[model samples]
Target: MTNKLSAGLAALFSLGTGPALAAQPVDWQMGFQPAATEIMTQIRGFESYTLWFIVPITLLVLVLLIYVMVKFRAGANPNPSKTSHNSLIEVIWTLGPVVILLALAVPSFNLLTAQYSPPEADFTVKATGYQWYWGYEYQTDEELSFDSLLLQDGERADAGKEDLATYPRLLTVDNEFVVPVGKTVRVLVTAADVLHSFAMPAFGIKIDAVPGRLNETWFNAEAEGLYYGQCSELCGKDHAYMPIAIRVVAQDKFDAWLAAAADDVEAANRNLIAAIDADAKSVDVAANVKN
Candidate 1:
């Protein structure tokens, strides 16, 4: 046990201080959210505090259980103490739990407030969950919208051979939610059909997508990469089909993408208006000739 414990500690320390520490373990999808930024730091702090409370309490209980079984067995203690009503022990037990709870609640409450606190978000996105797909809208920006559907097996294979540098099958989407890194993005989640959950584990966000109700969550990704998640709630037969892919790009890339989306929406609207006007003009000319 001693050797095993020491070896485990050594391994943990080594990984924590490895040479490639600067490079996050995104390739393997192994590392925790890098808390170098303030928001992520708050999340990491909550996780660490919870672990601290859980680990020692679990160990202490396990050790005490083992010690009692081994040292105070039936044979060892033939005559057991029959005193069951001790006010002092009761008070200690009661107060001990209360004190431990207070210790946990203090930080837990603070973290909850921080997580739910609304910030002056840089952007807003409304994610609409469909039966087996997603639709995203740039709520605060131009009236741009897009539908994201899962790739079929053959489609995924072709994409892998052609667009390998982009993304993989289960993680890839027809449309990606693009955002600038280091910006607080407020995501308004809802469903168009059945119930689903918008969950991104790395961002530590999981909110239900209920029809006729909007759920909200926020995240500020400080690094640039493609993060993937799926519809967490079991909605229907193809619940697994709906996936969420977000691309966090550099500020410049994000700006470019935004401008492009805006331009596309504008062009589409202009073409639509022109077509309507041409139809109206042709109708008027035809009516004049008939008269």
Candidate 2:
């Protein structure tokens, strides 16, 4: 137990010291991004749970196909039995799938409930999707709001984020959606022009942003860092350009950022970025020492 706790703490520290950019897909990436929230952990767990059913069933079907092809070949069995429908086999097949579905449904329902059932949200943010960008409004505190535009290639140097590690191409934004780590942040999603999807893989959240209707989703980030996502829905020609960047920070930092952003967004962003860089450097130094 002690070792496990220590290893968990080490992993969190590593994540803190890691890249400043939000979680993005790597070249030749296949699986989901690293889970930074309880919901994402549950999502990964449910994925693994379903895999147990999928893998064995797929293998069973493959083995059966091979056996039938080899054992009942034309050369081996010249006179084939006209067994069209066996009651026993039919019952087994019907009951087998039912059992499997029931097994899957139990966890599936639980996951759905956990996903939809938002615990009393600490704060709510309204995300309004535009033609190619996102506008965030802190509904709880009307004083804070900003538009998150994609950082273009030419703007990277001006933003002091030339390195891909600090701000990834097409994924980085001018203003990120900031939330405190370990807090349940309820996001109300909508669109101004067309349909869009606000998806954050690490948080296991993907909700549609309809023009007239509002969709809600929540995520409580366990680790403090940046987590990235993009608009999943195909809204327009520049749909791919709009990316979602979220910065999860400690509670005190979040409070300070909120206060500063309420006054001046640009200055607040600069301060937040500097603080994050310093925090990452400190964590890196500690990790190096422990090594």
Candidate 3:
């Protein structure tokens, strides 16, 4: 009853936190979020590697444009030079592009190979894309499956997720796809109604979710946190609202949650959140004690 009143008051007053959640990007963040996996680390590295070539080439092109604008004006040269055929200049221009393209292509091809060549997965989960939500199935020995939906405004405080800094509005879901940290998680992706995409930027994973076909991707999250993604393919009007949230926890915590979720998912979620909160509180207390 008290929780309901708080949620209602929050909704009525449009109350929310000002700071951006960790799962969210800060204002004007130019690069990707800090990489959470090895693949994402390599992706960031490749981006920087390409920029080394891109920046110099862009500057060179700009300088050539300015030089042409100044040196080849009609007043400066009544006749444009018809001597446009120099073998050395032609060879340099042609070979320079070839060298640059070859330099870019080697790493590009290697990155593509790495993205496809995933190590053996420890376990598998099925993620089915719906019109505006995601359904996940833990293909473990117990095989528990559940549909995850966005948390409505009225259900905030009741779920113990009223803390906006942790569970930001719109990004928070009722049930998140839970996995164990430091374990390779394989996701079988497909769609039920229309074409959608399963994309998680932090893990450098993006794959198409076709209706009848199943696509596969894998990620090994090193740190534990609430990671967020969204449907990359436009399926319907509510595509923007379809959010993907994954909770990575310790193996023991995951085992406990998995065992409890087989009977009641909601209760299992509540217990899991309670455990996580307790863990956080313990860490805070430890820090204070050290101080």
* lDDT (Cα, tens digit) per residue for candidate 1, span 1-291: 665666555544433222111222256664474553455577777788878879998998999899999888999999887987999979988998899899989988987898799688998999999998888899755667887787665765433323444455566665567777789999999999899999776676779999999999998876655567789999999997788877665576566566666667333323432333354455545444544
Candidate 1 overall Cα lDDT vs. reference? Answer: 0.70
The segments of candidate 2 whose C-alpha lies over 4 angstroms from its true place after superposition are: 1-14, 17-21, 285-291
Cα deviation of 261, candidate 3, in Å = 0.9
Clashing pairs in 2: none
Q: Can you write out model 2's per-residue Cα lDDT over 168-273, one digit (the tens) per residue? A: 8989988889999889999999999899999999889999999999999999998888889999999989998999999988899889999999988878887888
lDDT on C-alpha atoms for all candidate structures: 0.70, 0.87, 0.84
> Model 3 reaches what TM-score against the true structure?
0.91
**Which candidate achieves the best lDDT against the true structure?**
2
Candidate 2 vs 3: which has more lDDT: 2
By lDDT, is 1 or 2 better? Answer: 2
